[model samples]
Target: MVVLNWNGADDTIRCLHSLDAAALETPFRVLVVDNGSSDGSVGRIRREHPDAEILELPSNLGYGGGNNAGFRRAEEMGADEVLFLNNDTVVDSGFALPLLTVLRGEGGAGAVVPKIFYMANPSLIWYAGGEVSLRSGLVRHVGLRRHDGPRFSRPGTTGYATGCCVGLRVGVVRALGGFDEAFGMYAEDVDLSLRLRAMGLRIVFVPSSMVWHRVSGAFEGRLLRKLWLRTASTVRLLQKHGTPFSVPLFLLLLPLRLVPAAAGMFFSRLRREESV
Candidate 1:
């Protein structure tokens, strides 16, 4: 398990405690990447789980940066695979083994993500990998809210998976160089997914592997903040893939992007029974 930590001392402690109890079929090491946290988290973990490995950075490298550091350590350890779990997550006891089982057989499956449930609301599905419609330029969940029936219960390839709790092959990640640090935070996963797809690799959703995540805890619950980062990252991603004519293409698509967000706001207010 590779976790990135800031000042989340309490959550970090809890995550580690859960990992200690999660019985695995194979031996797996836990590496905590401390992104220059001043909460004395390193000291706390050392005092608590002395056997666990810890990597400390000089400053906060954001999510992509922190995870990249952990990925490097995992690579150096010669690990066959690396699983990235959020500091605010509790991995299910059967998580790692099931993922490993699927990974060993699935060709083109460079990365695999488990079914994530809201730590606060375990019944709700946080994400189910879906199709990215190029025509609409929107991403949708294949089995978001419907249920965990035959549709969602099966493991298959997806356009992308949440970075919250993903298991990746070490070689694939090393070749790709972990998450794109240029993204800093938001949409780094999206950028990573696109790159993997470009390489003819697949990102899969494995339902048997599960984890409970505290949604948006690291970024806090700031809509504007999420929007700003997401929009900016999307722009950067498009820009990189977009050629010199990218400007004209973005111009053509800018309205398409705004319309949905605007409509979403209107419906959100309507659902709350607030006057527009």
Candidate 2:
């Protein structure tokens, strides 16, 4: 597994610890990519987990580039599969085998993702499966905030899987050239999913496999910044893989997402001015 870190040393350390300590059915090694963290994350991670292989970047490479860097390394190392996990996640000990089994068994599956729950509220679901609409080409996360139950009992294929904890078929991904760096930090997973599907690969969601995440930990309080990145990435995705109406649909829906964020920014500025 490869965990990407950017200044979240504590979270990354904890994640490494989980992997080191988890009881997996098969042998595994971890590769940590310190995405140019200014917080001394590289030094700290080296000290904490001397066993993990470290890849130190000179500067931030966004999510796509950082993971691609790791993917390339994994490819060179002759890995059959690679898991891309966010540093903010604390994975379940037995999560690996089930996902790996599906990836190996399903010849058409390019990637598989585990069920995720919010770490703060363990019973609440973060992801189950995802859908990409054929008409609008819009992607939606299934069962985002719902509580865990038997309703989501079965495994299913999805159009996209969050990069938070995805197990990838390394050879196929490397041959396809991995993620498009044009996506940067957001929607890169969706772009990868689309490209894999174009190549006749399936994206699977395994309900039996689970991971806990501190949702969007890096951009937690920077809502507007995250919004803008997402907006830009969404447009890039549409342009790259648009149906006849995809661009038009995205354009029409853009403001519905952005206007609210702009209003929030406007009000925040107004409140500051009033205080002054």
TM-score for each candidate, following the candidate numbering: 0.84, 0.90
Give per-residue CA lDDT, model 2, range 226-268, as digits (tens): 7778777777787788777887787787767577656644553
Per-candidate local distance difference test: 0.76, 0.82
Instruction: TM-score for candidate 1, please give it.
Output: 0.84
User: What's the residue-level lDDT of 15 in candidate 1?
Assistant: 89
> Candidate 1, residue 46: CA error in Å?
2.6
Which sections of candidate 1 miss by over 4 Å? 134-136, 145-147, 242-276
Best candidate (score: lDDT): 2
